[model samples]
Every structure is written in structure tokens, then in C-alpha cells.
Target: MKFTLFSLCRRYPIWVAVLLLYAVASLVSPAMLNPDQVLNIVRVTAFLGMVATGQTIVLLTGGIDLSVAGVVTLVNILSTGLMLGDNGNIFVAMLACVAVAAIVGVTNGVLVAYFRIAPIIATLAMNSILFGVALVYTGGAPHGAAAPAFNTIAQGDILGFPASGVCWLVLSIAVAMLMRKTVFGRWIYAVGANARAAAMMGVPVRLVVVAAYTLSSMLAMCGGLLVTAYIGNPSLGIGNSFMMTSVVAVVVGGTALSGGVGGVVTTIAGALFITELNSFTNIAQASTGAQFVIQGVLIAASVVVYRLLARRPRA
Candidate 1:
């Protein structure tokens, strides 16, 4: 196969964006170049990275999971409430959280894959349901705190790197490999590229779709756990930011909103770029509305740029 600049950019726009953003950020705020500050960005990116990883998978399968935000909040509230600051409760809390997340994921999968509901509407409705359950469970006032031991996952370091970052790195590598080297991974892409064709080819389209959604929810739960660990307390709307940000990361990473393109690897850079952008905005004292506007522009720009690059003929 021949290579071209447009192809290269199409394959790795987010990586380019990350480098450019870092260069600009360092020039604008020298503190951004600090080792500690860089680590802090990595640390914070882990939470969104974890969630966006799943988003990447779902997008690959031609689906969206708006419910991720709800999953995150529900998991956060449930895990902390169940843990109640006790180490012994951590296991039970986690198990419960996993179960709940799985149920939610399965429901989303069934609705989209079997019942033929549109992904956006299905996941959006699911999000509402999940948030409602969380509200009812907490009565608008969540209780409990993260156990000290559990907090180590997000707050502690491994070999001078944030533990959560390390975890994100390991999981990303594992997931990337799965998507690239496994039959199931192939099925996901096949289904996304054309579900009718994939089904005709005996790809088990519904199963793949269901599995993708399940994995998405599970990873969202993992993200929720990490965030809960960092905050150490439950709060309503704790995951509100992730709803759009997760999609932003995935889209900016060059994943096709239409599906069957992009992978988790680029999303790592996408996550880093987003965190760096947020950090830079904070350092520059930009208003919250400004940040949102910037993000919206970024998303639109990325979509247009990627589409253009994708349309360019190979050299």
C-alpha cells in the first residue's frame, strides 16, 4: 500500500494535535513544562481515558453510549456508599458496582442490537434511567467516603507515575491488542462497517454489539471508581463532564462517528490533548463558557479535517 500525507494525518491527527498543543501550552505557560505538572495532566487524563476507551470500542461498532455519564455517576455514588470508608467493604462495593454496570450495559445492548432502537435514543434514555435510580438511591444527598486503601488506586504512585495512569496505560495496551489481534475485535469492526454484511458473513452482529456496549459500561464503571477514589466522596453530577468529554476524546482521536474506524491507541493521545487543553485554559484563567466553546470548535474542526483527509486520494 502507498502512503500519503493525508493518510498519515487521517491516521494520527490527534497525536499531531497533542504535540502542537503541548508546544503551545509550554510557550504560553512555562509551568506546563514542569515534570510535576506533566504528571498531573497524565494523572487527570486517566479518568477520562478509561471512559473514552470504551467509547472508542462502541464507536468502532457503530454505536454510542451516552449512558456512560450516568454509569459513572451511578457507580461513583454506589461504590462510595457501599464502601462507606471501610476497607472491608471495598470488595463488596466493587462487586455490586460491576453487577449494576453490567446490567445497564446489557440493557443498552439489547435495546440497540435486538430491539433495533437507535443507539443515541437508547443510551440517552438509559442515561436518564440510570441517573434516576442514582437519585432515588441517594435521595439527592449521597453518603459515604472512599476507603483509604481504595483511594490509593487514584492518589498513589507507581515508580514515580500516577497509579491511575499506570492502570490506564496497561488497560489501553491490553485493549488495543484485543481490538487489533482478536477475532472478537474483528467482529466489532465488521459489524460497525456494515451490520447487514457482517451478519450475512456470520459475524454474530448482535452479540458483538451487546459485548461492545457491555464493555463500554464496565469501563465507565472503572472510570467512576477511579474518580470516586480521587474525590473520596460522592457528589451528584460527578460524571456530568464525562458525558460529552468522552465523546469528544473519541471523536478527536479520529474515530469515525459513523463507525468501523479508529482504535484505542489514538484515543490515548486524544485524552492527553483534551486534558492539556483544559489545563491550559485553567492556567490562562479562561471562563467555563469559553472552555465549552473551545471544545465545541475543536470537535467541529476535527470532524471536518478528518473528513477532508479521508477523502483525499492516495499519492
Candidate 2:
């Protein structure tokens, strides 16, 4: 009973922390409770929340993608380049973006699964290569404006709430169902918990790993597209921070670095938490260094608590 309770507690620390943070923020400034401010938080948080969803999946498989930011860069470039002043060509442009994103995903998966490279090192090297590709493709500058329709997807409201936020919620529900009510979901946990044992049990470990990465890449592309719409112009390296940010959100959301745990709901909460922290800090006139210190301390504290709860006492 204690073990079960402890496990549940570790899995949900993010939600608990998020509630506390929201409560504190609300108290600190009632303006934080204003409907528009709350909407703004949800609006901005959805993009990263989607990216973190994919990140959580990969992390569940005991893998990581340091190339997500690079992938987003590539996607944004494609979106603008293909759709530039050509609304009629939108479908083709989108198809190309998806294809490229999937190809990148497959490449990463092949390297990590068949080549057996360490996830972090493999993805990091891939990121370097991707960075070079982005630079070469854009010649250090990228141009082209987002289509009005695409921008609407990112910025429009549905029933007075941000469309992207609604999309995030829908996607979150779909992913939750996938993770909790499917055999493949069970396979993910099994493989993450013990790949060797999973393989011995006849699970297709390689395929699962590949699929996880492919999904991550595709989701990242989706995020990039949204960001591209929001920004309305492509800039080189606009998404440079997303890889690390997504990883941090996933980790801080109570997802185990060791894998086979956590959910998209937690990841969404984590993204919101981080976003809120940044906004609050900015509002409070905190320096960049102070923000860093606070973030570092919060992450350290969360990890310590997670590790403590995850530890099994000797019988």
C-alpha cells in the first residue's frame, strides 16, 4: 500500500506543484486571476505543451531528442518558404513539411535503434547537423510571411478561448487515451522499464523506439508551424531554445529521467508552470540571473523529492 501510494505521489508531483504555484501567483497579484491574463497563459503555453507531449513519449522510452529545436527550425523555414505569397500552394507546403519532419524522425530512430548510439549523444549530434542544414538552407536569413489562415489557427479564439489552447486540450485527451487504454501504451512502459526483458518477452523494442522518435518529430513540426504562424515571419534559429525547454518541462513535470512514467497532462502542467514562472518573474522585475537561480533551485528541489519518493525501502 505504501509503495503504491508513493508511486502515485511521484507521478503527480507536477500537478500538485502547479496548483500551489497558481495559488501563490493568484495571491501575489489578483491581476493574475483576470480572465484575460489566464487566457494569455493558456494561449502561450499550448505550443510548448504540444512539444512537451512528444518529449514525454520519447522520455518514456528511455530516450531523448536534443534535435527538437533544430527540427522546429527546419519546419518553420519550410512553412514560410513553401507558402510564401502562394495561398494556393498551402497543402503542398504542409505535405512537404510533414514529409521532411517524418524523414528526420526516421533517421534519428534508425541511428539510435540500429546504430545503437546513446540517445543524448545521438540526438545532440543530429541537432548539430540539422543546425548546419538550416543555416545553409536559409543563408543565415529567412523570409516569407505566414498565411492569414495559418495565423488564425495560432491566434484565433473559439468560444472566447485561444484555438491553440483548445487544440492542446484535445491532443492531450487523445494522447491520454492512447497511453492509458492501448496495448502499444503498455508496450511503451514495458520497454522503458526494462528493454532487455521486453525483448525477451517478444516485444518489438526497435519498432517502438522508432515510432516514439517519429511521433516526437511530427509533433515538434506541428509546434513549429504554430510558432511560425504566431511570429508571421521566419527567422533563423527562432526555435533554438525549444529542445532544452521541452526536456526541462518534461523532467520537471515529474516524469522520470529513467523513463516509463508520467503523462501528457503532467507535461502540459509543467509547460504552464514554466511559462507562468517566466511571466511572473518578468512582472516582478527579477533579473535574468535571478530567474536562472530560481529555476535551478525549483528543479533541484523537485528532483530530490521525486528521487526520494521513487526509492524503494529495503525489506
Candidate 3:
């Protein structure tokens, strides 16, 4: 039992640390331990955590999806703009948003998988297109309120915990289990490790790549719903910062940018660490600019440290 728990700890130090921090915060300030406060933090983390999980999966398969923020923003608008007044419109609107996200994902995959375009450049261009499409759809101003049911996922708790938090936790566990205990999971790591080698070994690298992007799109759409509700309305550029934040969380959670080295559990920790930092900063009355400066420095320093630590001395 001890060894089992030790292994789990080693495999999920980031999450362990986050939980530890939560415990400490609660002890230090009892208010932080209150159900409402704790639930609020978990609820807020869901959108970021859900989006970051998709990013983690894509990165694990040796790719990045820069269009996530734009996809999310666009979907938020779709949900609000189309479904705000009619309950009957919600389902169709959601399908349309998801369909759009899938099309974008497929486009990204096609460019990177077959055209041999760099994933970064391909996704970046896609991001531009998605942003433009969103701008055109909204005409420079976004209007629409998220439906109450949609908001409930982020706000309503079951016996004390937000439903979105539960959703995130369950989804993370499922994804982690899928990655660690399934054949597709193995294929993902293999592709991330070496696409050419994976092909040589009979892995369907191209299909895997495309499928990863599709999954990413799905996750982004889910996050968009949560974000729209979390903020209470659709606004222009509300999801603008998510792309960077998702990448930062993935990296800070100990996932290798080059791929195949981390899990969703760690990304959750990275999200909490960031959210906690933000909360602490707000508590300290720090400016938004100051927060960004500190966060940027931390990200840069972390990358350097990762590079140094990940290096091997010349043999």
C-alpha cells in the first residue's frame, strides 16, 4: 500500500502539490476552506483545466493547437447568439458549433499531417481564420446571454461541489485512464515519440494525428460552454488569453513540449497553481499588468529550467 501510494505520488506530484496547497490555504484562512469558496475555485478552474487537458493530449501526440482560444470564443458566441431566446435552438446551435470546431481541427490536421506544414504555423494560421470568422459573425460586438442550464454546470454544485468541477475531475480521470491503460493511448505516446518510427512499427500515425485534433476540438467546445456560463455572457475576445494559458499550464504541469511525457493530472495542478497565484495577487491588490509580468517571467524561467534539467551531458 505504501509503495503503491508512493508510486502514485511520484506519477502525480503536481496534483499532489496542488492539493497540499489547498490544504494549507484552508488551514491558513478558514474562509478558503468554506464550501462556497472552495467550490468557486474548483468551478473557475474547470474551463481552464478542460481546455488545457485537450492541449495536453495534442502535445502528447507531438502537436499543438493554437486555435483553441478562437474555437472556444466562436463556440461561446454560437451558444449565446443562437440559443439565448429559444430552448429549441440550443441543441442545433451546439451541433453547429461542434461541427465548426471539427472542421477547423480537420483543417489543422490536414495541413500538418499531409501537407507537411509545421504544426505551429498551421495552427497559428487557423487561429487567425477562426478569429476573423468570429469577428465577422459578431460584427465587432458580441451579444447573447448563456442559457441558465448551461450556467448551472459551472455554478451549481451537488452536495457542495460545482458540477463542472465534477465534470472536469471525471473527464480527467477518464482521459488519464485512456492514455495509460489503453492501446490508443500507447499509440499516442508512440506517435509523439517518433511519428516516422511509429509508422515503421505499423502505427497509423496520420489517423492518430487527425483523431487527436478532433478530440482537441471537442474539449475546446466543452470549455467554451463552461466559459460562457462562468462569465455570464458572451463578450468579444473573452477567450483571447486561453491559448497561452493552456500552453503555460501544460508546460508548467511538467508535460514536455516535444511530447509524450506528462498526463492530464499534472495539467490540473498547473491550472490550480496559476489560479492560486492569480487569487493571491488579487488579494495583494496587484495590477493585471503586474500579474502578467510575473507570470511571463515565471514561464520563461520555467522553460529554461526544464531545458537545463532535461539535458543530458555529452557522452
Candidate 4:
């Protein structure tokens, strides 16, 4: 019984951390327990959650997508610019955003999978290129407004629940199912676990890697669109925060940095934890610097905890 408990804890440490965090937060700010406040936290978490879902997939394939931050910003600018607050333009704007995102994803994938470029360097370079493009297009000042219908995606609620939250939950379930139930999902895990071995087993390693990167970029774009809608305006550097938070959420959710060990479901908990942490800090009037420090410490601590748990022998 003890061993079973330990194993369960080892496998799902993120859930444990989340419970502890909520308990402590409730103690510090009892108002945090309110249903309205809790729902608000879920609503805000949807954006980060979407980005981190893609990050989780990339990480599972033993890669990183630093370009996700850039994808977010670019999509925000492109979507709103094309939409120009006109509802009729929404379809065209969104289609353009997805096309650009797919191109970016495919490029990153080709660089890393086909050309053997390091994932970090390749994605980082793509990020820089994207930022440059955004800068050139926006002329240092992005201008546009999200249409009322577009804004409803993030700003409206359904049956007293946040629409964004509902969307995220539905999407996450679909992704989780895809990863668990499909042959492609198995290929992803196989490749992440051992690329050479996967290739030997006829796993089409290159294709899997490319698909992972493509999905990452596409999801990052989705997240960016949601953020654009919520704010109803395009803003430069709007996605800068996701660069750190997405990876942090993935790591804290018990996903192995070395890859092949985590999934989108746990990332959901991780996103919630991160959003709650930020909300609590804001309520406590913590400085931006302090918040960074807290997040940094949390990441380090989670890494160590997971490593220790993973290293422990099963009884």
C-alpha cells in the first residue's frame, strides 16, 4: 500500500503541488476560495494553457519551441490587422494567421529534423525572425481592434462559465485523446524516448518531429489569437511573457525536460498553478521582480523533486 501510494505520488506530483498551493493560497487570502475568483483564475489560465499544450507536445518529442512567443505576437498582429474590427474579415484574418503559423512551424521542423540544427538555436532564430517581421509590419506601433464577435471568444462566458476556459478544456481533452489513442501518439513517445531506436523500428522519426513542431506553432497561434481577442487590440510584445511561462508550466507539470515523460493533461494543472501563483502574488502586491524570483525557485524545486521521485526504486 505504501509503495502504491508512493508510485502514485511520483507519477502525479503536479496535482499534489496544485492542492498544496491552493490550500496555502486560501489560508493567505481566503477570498481566493470564492467560486467567482476560482473561475476567474481558470479563465485567465486558458491562454497560457493553450500555448503550454503545444509546448508539452514539443517537449515530449525531446524538442523545444522557443518560437512560440514569436508565433503568439505575430498572430496577434496579423489577425487584428487583417480583421480591423470588421466582423466580416474574421474568417480571412484567421485563415491567414493559420497559414503563416503553418509555414513557420514547417520551417522550424525542417531546420531541426532535416538539417539537424539544434532545437534551441533553430527555434530561437525563428523567434528573432518573427519579431523582425512583426516590427517591420507594425512600424513599431501595432494598430487594430478585434471585432465584437472575435472578442467574444475570450471575453464572453457560456452558462456562467468562461468561454475561453471551456474551449481550452475541450481542446485539451481532444489533444490528450489524440496523444493517447492514436498510432501517431505512440510514434511521438517512441521518438522522444529514443530517436535512433524509433527510426530503427520504422517510426518515421523525421515526420514525427516535424509534426510536433508544426502543432506547436499552430497552438501558439491559437493562444495568441485568444489574447488578441481578450484585449481587443494589438500590442507589441504581447506574447513575451509566454516564452518563460509556457516552458515553466510544462516543467512544473512534471514533464521531463529530457522528454518522453509528460502530456497535455498534466500541463493543464501546471497552467492553473502558474496562473494562480501570479494571481496570488498580485493580490499580495508582490513586485514583478519578486514574482520572477518565486517562479524561478518553483521551477528549480520542481525539477529536483521530480528527479528524486523518478530515481526512487519501485518496491
Measured with C-alpha atoms, the lDDT of residue 21 in candidate 4 is 88
**Best-to-worst ranking by lDDT:** 1, 4, 2, 3
lDDT of 1 by residue, 1-315 (tens): 547755556557788789889999889899999999999999999999999999999999999999999999999999999999999999999999999999999999999999999999999999999899999999998999999999999999999999999988899889999999999999999998999999999999998999999999998998999999999999888989898899999999989989998899999988898999999999988999999999899999998988888788655
Q: Is candidate 3 or candidate 4 better by lDDT?
A: 4
Q: Candidate 3: global Cα-lDDT?
A: 0.81
lDDT of 2 by residue, 264-310 (tens): 67888888889888877877778999998998888888788778866
Model 1 stretches with alpha carbons more than 4 Å out:
1-11
Pairs that collide in candidate 2 are none
lDDT for model 1? 0.92
Local lDDT at 6 for model 3: 53
Summarize candidate 4's per-residue lDDT along 125-181 as a digit string, tens digits.
999999999999999988888899999999999999999899888988788898999
Candidate 3 residues lying further than 4 Å off, grouped into runs, are 1-11, 19-30, 300-315
Q: What is the TM-score of each candidate against the true structure?
A: 0.96, 0.93, 0.89, 0.97
Query: How many angstroms is residue 303 displaced in model 3 relative to the true structure, after the best TM-score fit?
Result: 4.7
Q: Between prediction 2 and prediction 3, which has the larger lDDT? A: 2
The 10-residue segment with the lowest total lDDT in model 4:
1-10
